[model samples]
Target: MADIEERRPRNKATTFLLVLAAAAFVVASALRLLGIDGTRHMVATTALVPYFTAAGVLLGAIALLARRWFVGTVTLLVALVLVAAVAPRAFPDARPIGVGQEVRVMAANLLVGKADAEVLVAAVRDHAVDVLALQELSPAMVVDLERAGLDEVLPHRVFLAEPGASGSGIASRYPLTARDLAGPSTLRQAGALVALPGADLEVVSVHPLPPVTPDGPEPWQRDMAGLPRPDLNGPYRVLAGDFNATLDHVGLRRLLNHGYVDAADQVGAGLDPTWPADAVWPPPVVIDHILVDDRCPVDTFQVVDIPGSDHRAIVSQFVVPAR
Candidate 1:
């Protein structure tokens, strides 16, 4: 009787922890599903839905192993909700193989004009990138990039090189013509039409305002909503750069709904993180992306490390269907 009583407190404590874990899982799942982006911090938290969901699954499994049937079952159910939410992105539709010309694209944000020009140029050269989308470009960085022989690799270019986060540019091996896109007035997002041999592709370098302050959330939402949507029947499209939103963000998800798919997600690499490259721990979220239309089939997607930038670069090989 004495031994049983001594174990009772431990059992109660365990039960309490299990219940707490389950409740946290339920709350996180609900917040993500609900797509609440009303506040700045909430929007930032939304970016971590996948991580939260993953934690829930781990805790639920632990509960199950401990034979806490009721707690285990409830936690598992909550965890399952997260699994369902991420299933579409984690396992996207299979892409068609051997149907189009290959186009390799690389995108990177320069950390408000702080990325190394030589490192950026090296990435383009080493990766043999056909198109390079850069955000947070500055006049000085543009000069440095040009001096680093970026022009030799990607001769055709369109750029709006400014200071701070409101700068973007595109460099392509093929001819490029500037195209206007609707977005926030303050952000320096730019679009260009790349005239390929047999097909035309619209590539946009986007850098939405980060949601970090009390007034940042609304503009961030507006910036995402303002991005141009691809015409499914028209030219092939690719939107790349630091979007300041993750797959978990409803705004980015809504953008994807407009006949576009994330290149990394399509290739089963959706869980890779791309921001805070210099973090002490591994980056926790993927804010950079290569979003392509269905007309373009993704072959492979990779996240490349760039020195002096807070965000890593995304390199994707896309097969644009021949017109």
Candidate 2:
């Protein structure tokens, strides 16, 4: 009788813990699904949806092993919800045949002029990147890139190369005409029109503030919302750089809602992380991206490592229809 009572308390304690864990997961899952991140912490928290999905699976298994059938069922349901949200990213989608200009675009954050200039230039050369969008660019980095033969690979340029992280720029194998895409952003988010063979591509180097800033998520949200929307009648557009927000964020999602598709997501490589490259803590997350007009077909997507930078560069190839 004594042993039975002792075990009963222990069983109840286990059940309580499991239920608490399940509730936390359910809340997180719901936040991601509904896209309700009002606070900076919530914004940062929701970026871990992929990790949440994995954790939910483990949690469900633990509940089942504990013989907590009800908890197990609920946790598994939450896991299912997460899986439904995340699984599609792992499989490629049927892309339309692109019989137009083939553009190899790449975006990299220079970590405020600290990323390896030679390595970045080499990536541009090896990948044959037609357009390179850069964030956190500096005038010194510009000189370094040119010294490293970036101008030879992608000669045309439009840059707002300040000394700090506020700077941004674009370089292209084709001619580039600068376009102002100024918004409520602390960074100089620059844009240019790439004069391609048969079509012009409006490319923007995007870098909205991180939600984890001292000012909070409002500025970040505003910047994201203020980003240029896709116009079907206009030239095909591509926005690339350190977005600082993932597809899971409502800000990014809202921007995507306007006829834009993530290049990585289009080809099932969406879950690949592009931030915190050199660090062990905070794991890694996909904060950088290449968003294009939905009409464009993405061919190949790759995330390349840049030495001395905390961000990995995303290189993508796609075709824009010639009008």
Candidate 3:
């Protein structure tokens, strides 16, 4: 009788904990599905939906092993929903091949102008990067990049070089004509038209302000909304840099809805994290991106490490279709 009573309490405790954990998962799943993160905390939490999906699967398995059929079913359904949202990103989608021109684009946040210039220039030369978009650019960093032979390989430039993080620049192997993309934001976003062989491709170095405070998300959301939409009638457009947002963020998904496709997502590298590269806390997240028009077929995508930078470099090759 004594042993039976002890086991009963222990079983109840386990059930209670299981229910609590299941509730958390349910909430997370709901937030992900709704895509209405209005505050900084909620926005940060939504970024971890991929991790929650993994937890949901494990929770479901545990519940089933303990014969808690109701909890097991619920958790499994939540896991399915999360999986359905993120799994396609793991598999490459069928993209049409373009026989016109091959263009390699690379974007890197310089960690407030502190990333290694020599390494970045080497990456450009090694990867044959035709257009390079740089964020967190500074005047000294521009000088450093040139000293490291950036100008030799990518001579054409459009710079909004500042002393601090509010700076952006684009260097291209081909000529760059300044394209106006000014906006009411904190970051110095830049844009230019790349004179390619057959077309003048428009490339924007994007860096939206991050949602850090309670009132910060509003401005961040505004910056996201203000991003230019891809025009099919115009030249091919590629937006690259640290967006301060992720695929799970409704803002980014909304931008993608406007005829833009994330290069990493199209190539099965969507889940790859790009921020907080050298940090131990906050793990890592995918905030840097190379967003191209839907017509441009991505051939290759890579996340590269640059010493002293908090964000990884995203280098991608795209085949721009004949216009």
RMSD to truth, every model: 2.2, 1.1, 1.2
> On a 0 to 100 scale, what is the lDDT of residue 152 in model 3?
95
Best by lDDT: 2
For candidate 3, list the clashing residue pairs, or say none: none
Clashes of 3: 0
- Expressed as tens digits, the lDDT of each residue in 81-148 for candidate 1 is 77887766656568766476789999999987888889889999999999999999999889999899
TM-score of each: 0.92, 0.97, 0.97
Per-residue lDDT for 1-323 in model 2, tens only? 99898899888899899999999999888889887977888888899999999999999999999999988989898898889878888778899876899999999999999999999999999999999999999989999998899999998999999998999999999999998765557778998989999998999999998889878988888778778988777888999999899888898888788888899988999998999996767979999999988889988899999998999999999999999
Q: Lowest-scoring 10 consecutive residues by lDDT in candidate 3?
A: 179-188
lDDT of 2: 0.91
Task: Report lDDT per candidate.
Answer: 0.85, 0.91, 0.90
By lDDT, the better pick of 1 and 3 is: 3
- Stretch of 10 with least lDDT, candidate 2: 179-188
Position 238, candidate 1: lDDT: 88
lDDT of 3: 0.90
Where does model 3 exceed 4 Å of error? none
